[model samples]
Target chain A: MHSFESLSKDFAAFFQKSHFPDQPASLYQPADYFLGLGGKRVRPVCCLMGNELFDEILPDTWQVATAIELFHNFTLIHDDIMDKAPLRRGMATVHSRYGEPTALLAGDVMLVVAYDYLNKVRSEHFHRIIQLFNRTAREVCEGQQLDMNFEKSETVSLDAYIKMIELKTSVLLAASLKLGAILGGAGEGNLHHIYEFGRNLGIAFQVQDDYLDAFGDPDKFGKQVGGDIMANKKTFLLIKALESADPALKAELDALLQSNHPDKVEKVLAIFRACGVDEWAKTLKDQYLSAAFQHLDDIAVLSKRKEPLRSLANFLVQRDY
Target chain B: MHSFESLSKDFAAFFQKSHFPDQPASLYQPADYFLGLGGKRVRPVCCLMGNELFDEILPDTWQVATAIELFHNFTLIHDDIMDKAPLRRGMATVHSRYGEPTALLAGDVMLVVAYDYLNKVRSEHFHRIIQLFNRTAREVCEGQQLDMNFEKSETVSLDAYIKMIELKTSVLLAASLKLGAILGGAGEGNLHHIYEFGRNLGIAFQVQDDYLDAFGDPDKFGKQVGGDIMANKKTFLLIKALESADPALKAELDALLQSNHPDKVEKVLAIFRACGVDEWAKTLKDQYLSAAFQHLDDIAVLSKRKEPLRSLANFLVQRDY
Candidate 1:
């Protein structure tokens, strides 16, 4: 079985050699710029692994992988605009560097280009692939809407938050794996199993992201630790703290959440730890990881063939960044 | 041949009976609101007419038509945000009524829904339809970018302006007809003919819109006469005036274009007439219409079968509103 590191290297090489149209400098330059600002490329790598697990990596699989990457970047561009985020990947965000209109168009063109790649798949696979993509795309938008709604919300249930994260982050990852499996000629049952594996893995990944943001070493994490806390973002940590705190502590937590306290991150972390929210988050992450592994085990593929995915999942669960 | 009136009525019924999902209220509501505001339904009608000109209207034809309509509205919503326009179809624009972020998502979901409709086409037609749609979609973005670029530009050539409008306004209309033609099982030659027909007709329609904006009576036009002139839009007339004017008259025209003169519309109109730009615009519009008819005539289908499209073209040419 190929290691995750090898698969990621292959994805990087393929992406590096990929050609994005250079004309319409206004619409595409920003796309090129954003795509060049590299991330971990997790979704596309998962897609490749999904495909390779069932069959030899097909040409259409690469196309699907690239399309998913583009789609992810498209979401990032638009989400940054909505969130007013200044940076992505330690660089200026698309909307911040390019004006909002250009960023919007760039994001839009990315979607069109992504579909263009998907359209290149064989006709037999085209309809199902496009349908899955459209449904997932709509769900992502709905998830973004729900996330925006949460900003003004007074209290958010853990279930609602989980649902939002599932829609926003998990489903795409799930769809990515299913699409790859579909291209790889996996059975319907296997498709569902791989999708569930991806979905649960994505949730665990996001919860871990929240945990890392508050508790991780800043140097290793490669992001500002407690940035979410400083912004009073309704992450899993904050929501759990709100839900589980006693009245006096709840009032204190609420005041801190509402305040521009310079030490807000420190204060919020203390509250979370004091309330056992930190430990709770770790437990939640572990539960999701276990569920993900269960789904992975349920797939009918040989355990040897699944080793790459299993190892990748373990790596994700233990990653510092 | 079906009458344009009947085809349009059919389109209206189809659109009215169509269901857009009601959930994700933030995302879909603005889409519904935008689609609900009735325009002429021109693109979809063209699609239907294209379908009827060849074969019986197939299920896929309506899907293509709806996809085109949705795509057009998607462009409108995003364009409104970019242009900061306050109105569309005599109502507040999507971004104006819904906030920019909601409007952005609405446009995005509309595109997804558009693809969803396109996805329903038979796999035989799916790849070609999607490829064409993607190309046209990218061109539209480039065209919008060029239009925005022109806002900061001091000089825009007549050719450049026409190219921008062709990309911005013409291709989708062309693509709509071509998609319908493809679904109707039209030959490759006929598809090209119909696409050219739509393209030339769209350019003529836009030039006429510019003409009516400057020359038509406001009561008949149903829009403010000289609104483009008031906004200092670089219409066919304006560009031609700039290209053809004598030095003294050119200086005067340039000064008037730059001024917020109360009688700016009258002054610009007078200058355009003096420089024969109005005449040039009419001649250009006529040239496009004639070219459109030539393509329509070239279609191997019987002339009688082509009457609906011809009639629609004529109505577009003579439209005051």
Candidate 2:
């Protein structure tokens, strides 16, 4: 079985072929620019891992991986516009670099190109793969709408937030694995286990991401500590703090959220610590990680064949960053 | 053979079922709302007509028809946002009424739903249908981008404008017909003829639309006369006039385009008439309509089976409006 790192390199080499045409440079160039601003390529790698876990990876798996990556970037471009975000991965976002109109079109064409890639995949399960993709794509949009709704809302339940994260962040990851597995000729029973594995691993990774943003060493984490706190962005820690804090501490946390004080991050961190949110976040991450491992264990594959996915999951959630 | 009017009614009835879920009303509601604002279901009905031309309409044709309509509406929602159009079908555009962010998501989910519908079709040629849809979708995006680019450009050539219109308007219509024909067990040759028929018909219809906007009575046209001229929108007549007019007339047209004078429409109309653009538009429309009919005649189907499409084409381009 191929390791994540090896497969990632393979996917990168394969993806270097441009997905868009040269003309209408205004529409396609921004899409190319954003795709060029590479991330970890985790989702596409997850697709490859998903396939490898079931069987020798088929040629169609790479196409599915490429589709997943393109779809992810499409969401990011549109989400950045909706969020009015200026920067992504420390570079100007598509909307901020190109105009909003062009960015919107760019996101659109990326999605179209992603489907074109999917259409190129020749698999017995092509129809099912497409159905899962459509459902997941719709859910992601719903998740974005719900996230935007939460910004305007005064209160959001933990269940609601978790649902949003699953829809926004987890399902695509889960779907990627399932897509690959589908192409790999995985049986229905194995498909369920791998999908659950991805879903839980994704949630655990997100929890770790939130925890690191607030508390990890900035040098190690590769981001400014407590940046979410400074932005008054709601994360798992803040939500837990609000739910678990004593009345006085809750009032203080609310006040901190209202102000842009110089010490706001420090103050919020203190409150999070006081309410045991930082510790709770770690425990939550561990619980989801354990559930993920349980699902991975339940898969019908030999334990040896599952090693790459297991290692990748560990790397994703165990990282300080 | 189904008349366009009958097929249109069938499409409307079939489309009465809501395309989205109730949860996250923010995302789905705008999409539903946009679809509710009725326009002529031209493209979807064309699908039905195309199917009927080859054989009795199949069950899959309705699904393809639904997909085409949803895809068309998706483009309209996003285009309305890009154009900053406040009104559509005499009501607030999706972005203006629901907000840009929601509107963007709405358009996205509508597209996802469109794919979902397409996935429902049980066709032997399913893969080819998807490929066609994907190609057309990408071309439409490129077309929109080109249209936006032209708005900022100092001058746009007639060929460039025609290409834009073909991409933006004609291809979808052609694809709709082709999609239906594909499902109705059309041989390859008939598919080409029908697609070309739709393409030329679409161009002719657009020419008529441009002409009606400039010279038709407002009461008959159901829109303000010369609305395109007032907005300084580049159209076939405007481009043709500029190309054909003497230097003095071209200067007058240029100055009028630069200003929002109360009589700008009248002045431009005068220049257009002086340049014989009004008469020229009629000849151009006939040229395209004849080409469309020629292709229709080339289809292997009985000539009687071609009546509905021929009549629809004539109705589309020959109407005063």
Alpha carbon lDDT at A117, candidate 2:
86
Off by over 4 Å in 1: A17-19, A319-321, B17-19, B319-321
Residue B86, model 2: lDDT of 99
Pairs in steric clash, model 1: none
Model 2 misplaced stretches (Cα beyond 4 Å): A319-321, B319-321
Q: Which numbered prediction scores highest in TM-score against the true structure?
A: 2
Clashes of 1: 0
For each candidate, the DockQ is: 0.83, 0.88
Candidate 2 lDDT tens digits, B200-317: 9889888999999999878889999888998888899988987888999898888888899988888999899999999899889889988998999999989999899888887778
Q: What is the interface RMSD of each candidate, in Å?
A: 0.9, 0.6
What is the Å distance of residue B146 in model 1 from its true position? 0.9
Candidate 1 chain A minimal-lDDT segment of 10 residues: A17-26
Q: Output DockQ, candidate 2.
A: 0.88
lDDT of 1 by residue, A157-222 (tens): 999999999999999999988888888888988999999999999999999999999999888887
